[model samples]
Target: MTGEYLAGRGAYILGLITKRIWFRASLFSVAAILTALVAGWVAPFIPYELSLTVGGKAVDNILTILASSMLAVTTFALSASVGAYGSATSTVTPRATQLLVDDRFTQNALSTFVGTFLFSIVGIIALTTGLYGPEGRVVLFFATIVIVAVIAITLLRWIQHLSSFGRVRDTIERVETVARRAMQAWAEAPHLGAQPPVAIPTGLLSVYPADTGYVAHIDVAGLARIAERYGLTVHIAELPGAFVYPERPLAHVSEAVDDKARMAIKNTFSILPDRRFDQDPRFGLIVLSEIASRALSPAVNDPGTAIRVLGAGHRTLADFVDTKRGAKACIHLRVHAPALTIDDMFNDFFRPIARDGASVVEVQLRLCATLSSLAAHAPDIFGKIARRHADAAKMRADDALSFEGDRAALHMSDF
Candidate 1:
């Protein structure tokens, strides 16, 4: 049965839209323009004496200065942001750049800068056209004061944000935060609130992917609705973050699937060129592991970074295990999707670091320790997988570590 997903298609789409920089910027611009126009409406409510106290010339000068300065500030901000993106790509991993791009603090700062610029421009235009009489000018002046204050505070915060904006720790924190969120969401709605799919029944109809790419999102609720309406069982063959080809099955329908049904089913699975972090827990783990791998690379040779990321990965997994997800809340009884395997997560989160940092004793020690700790997290589930990785890491250390002391040190560690 294709049951409802915790997040519907609209929510999934909205999640993507909100991550965009321009969306927030466009909203801020529109709001600024509205604010400029609203002064005329507010003008009537202000007393004539208040208008007399407000100087049109001073308001005009402030707007002029604000407009000119904001243009320069916005340009600098863009350049800084672009530089940070480049830095994150080179020092961290290209995969992490998207997170930085979607950073709310940076986005809001840029939006404020752009919005304030537009607000100033509109206010100046209104002033020049005499759209704001003395009363209107008073309202506009007060608005300008508020804008200036906001800009001042924003500038200070932005300056502080830029200090570690694209640094390695910052990027890793960003990845860790997202990875935790994904894990938490998964914990809340295990298997997307669907039954763990069993072996396909003999006569199940297969739905193939139309394109070759990663499954970015799956509209689970849509499938449930379609399945319920059509009176069929829909077993989701792939989860978000899965790579798919034309030959691969996206889902299996229990009844005969018509052209309309096939298309509808396919639409529920959004395939994109790259995997996204949202709705994809494993992708976050993979990206975090990738960061550790990059840090372990000979070009960078930054083991400290890899070590820090291990801590993040450990914390992310530990949080998932520790979360009080009492029972499997299966909401979408109609949709059957596979549950995430701990082994795969262990591989995704730690295998690469173990492989790449095999030579470093500190890396191996940290890796083995984290694995043993994870094994202790849920002995039945994580114990075996954690031991598997720990054994692999120990084996790698045996080959890579020249001194017996180093080998013995790793062998002696227990959780």
Candidate 2:
């Protein structure tokens, strides 16, 4: 089952690549031919190596041109194939997460497919043609292989980004789950009132005018800082922007949120704490502000030993600001225009939170739901951008198809 999932999904990802301009093998071929032609033109005449008359007709020049053309085509193909591998890996991961039943196994399969696919093709080419030889063709062939390897390495980082996403998704789920369970346990134990701590989800609250929306530029820094001070690890990594080689293409985010609390604090202060750490679900607290300062008290403790924190992200940020006097922080940039409104705000943050999760299955299901909503609302967004940027519009089509198909599968499973 695992192998089948890997092969099937990997192929699907590869199929996605075929539709993209970058994966069109012909371009690489053309480049190789051009490189050979240019090199041949500059070659000094050697009586032994270069002969205008070969038995009957002039052939050395013609052969050089022909070989160069072949080399160009081969080189282009090899270069483009690197992009193909990247696109394939990226596509397979998110789809498998949503479509496959067993996520861990799916992830393993996806990883294997990445390593195996690259190795098999390159390995076969190397084995069949002697990589080290006196023949120029053989030498050129090996060089082409090397170029392909470089491209593959450069592009495969997208797979790593996707893997990071999976890990982050898992961590966020735990944060939510542990918090929810802790709240429930606190409310149920002993003398709790009818109304427990009202826990709003992550994407909820009045996101400052600029903070709202599906656009990448959300005002998360304030919340991130608050999360840090409170002990939730915050590592702010950039989300993949428009299908480039992933690896968190963010340049310089003053602060990023991580799902781990201790790490968050450590990162915020830029200090390494003198303590060993493992992910423990026992650090929940409730804060009450007084005239002098804010007071934190243990609000809920689970019998099974789960600790959860209470308070919205924004409120936490406010607390951090109040306590710290003056500190650099994230603020919303408002755009008061006639076209946008509050519903946009609701969709921007709250909607995602309404679709909550605590496990991989739950996160996958929720992600599918959230993404579907975004796609339906913004179909032309990714479609238009991809079409304009990638020389081949097929890339746009494949991306749309993958996201759309994944959305549908998730919807079907809703039954």
Candidate 3:
């Protein structure tokens, strides 16, 4: 290990932080505190007569009520969000739950509640401590009323959001949105801004990882810099979502490198205990398949959801194929990365669901149609894999499904 901190890219780090629930809530709370102090700053411009009519008593009472009530409301909102996560895990799939945890709608609702509570607390503290004079009190009163209105609006929006917060359809849509974006990015830059891989040289030195796990992210720019400094050609052996152990070679260097260079190369790859959605587009496909598999389980027996996932998968893959034809060459000069294959993507998205939903005639029909549709869109790219999965799924369906009529209907499609 380089013993250097691996922070990934700045933009990637910022993306991760923004997805966090506490980060949003903390920002809101800080804003609320700052808003509380503004009353004193703007008080000088207000008329003294206006301050006489609106005493501190009304504002204090409102703040006290908000402070007391908002805590309970915030607690309840948190519980609901937690419950949604659990429901999504059980009903959808564990892999799909992280999206819920990082969902902006859920985070925003909780942040509003938490921020409002903190604002109330600050207002009450200021009033009791005589921090604001009469004009400040008048300003504070108007601020309290505005905040109350905001709270009311937030509550209304929260109620509407809760209706389908963690529902299977809602969660699946979220997954589709993320997967499509990742796929589009992958299509646009299949090599992650690195040059396409060339054949390995006769006798290159291999660089091994110190830790073992999935490659969550690769700092290609960092790799390029290292390659430039060492005057070496770097062939990446593993990409993001690929598992590695201490024994596995992460890259092959053209020549022997110093310890610092070796460590710098190693530190460029961020290996995590689990895969993340940002870089590895195929991980998202696997997750959608997992969700379908869970729905097809005997305990759940929701073939409709499985069929729906097939459509989501189809749409995501279709978008990739459409964008891939015009993809531009990557710009990085020193780093070489293997391109992600559509064959692997087809397997990641369709295999498990084909196994789990084998017996469901509707699911099989939908699966065949989904594959056939993709093949129709880009036969050169997906036709072979689509037919391959369709054949495999057909055999499974034929065995699991006893009725000949259902099998006849499945055979009706030319998938």
Measured by lDDT, the strongest candidate is 1
| Tens-digit lDDT track of model 2 for 1-415 | 1111112223434543454443433444454444333333333322323332222122233333433443444344344434433443343222212212222332332333333333334433433454312233333333445544544563465345345443323432333343234333322221111111223325321211112121111123333445436533222222111111223222122233444533322222211111101111012111101100111112321111111111221222222112321111112121110111223322322222222211123323433343343334444532232222222212322333446654444446422
TM-score of candidate 3 to 2 decimals: 0.94
Which 10 consecutive residues of model 3 have the lowest summed lDDT?
A: 1-10
Task: Please state every model's RMSD to the true fold in angstroms.
Answer: 2.4, 23.0, 3.5
Model 1 misplaced stretches (Cα beyond 4 Å)? 1-5, 326-328
Ranking by TM-score: 1, 3, 2
* Residue 166 C-alpha lDDT in model 1: 93
lDDT-better candidate, 1 vs 2: 1
Q: Rate the local accuracy (lDDT) of all candidates.
A: 0.87, 0.29, 0.86
Of the pair 1 and 3, which is ahead by lDDT? 1
Comparison by TM-score, 1 against 3, better one: 1
Per-residue alpha-carbon lDDT of candidate 1 for residues 36-58, written as tens digits (9 for 90 to 100): 98999988899999877776576
Candidate 3 residue lDDT tens string, 1-415:
1111123465556767788898999999999998888899999999999988786477888888999999999999999999999999888888889989988878988998999999999988888888898899899899889989988998999999999999999999999988887777777666777889899988899999999899888888788888888898899999889999999999999989999899999988878898887667898899999989989999999998998899899888987767752233465688899988887898898989889989999999999999899899989988898999999999999999999999999998768
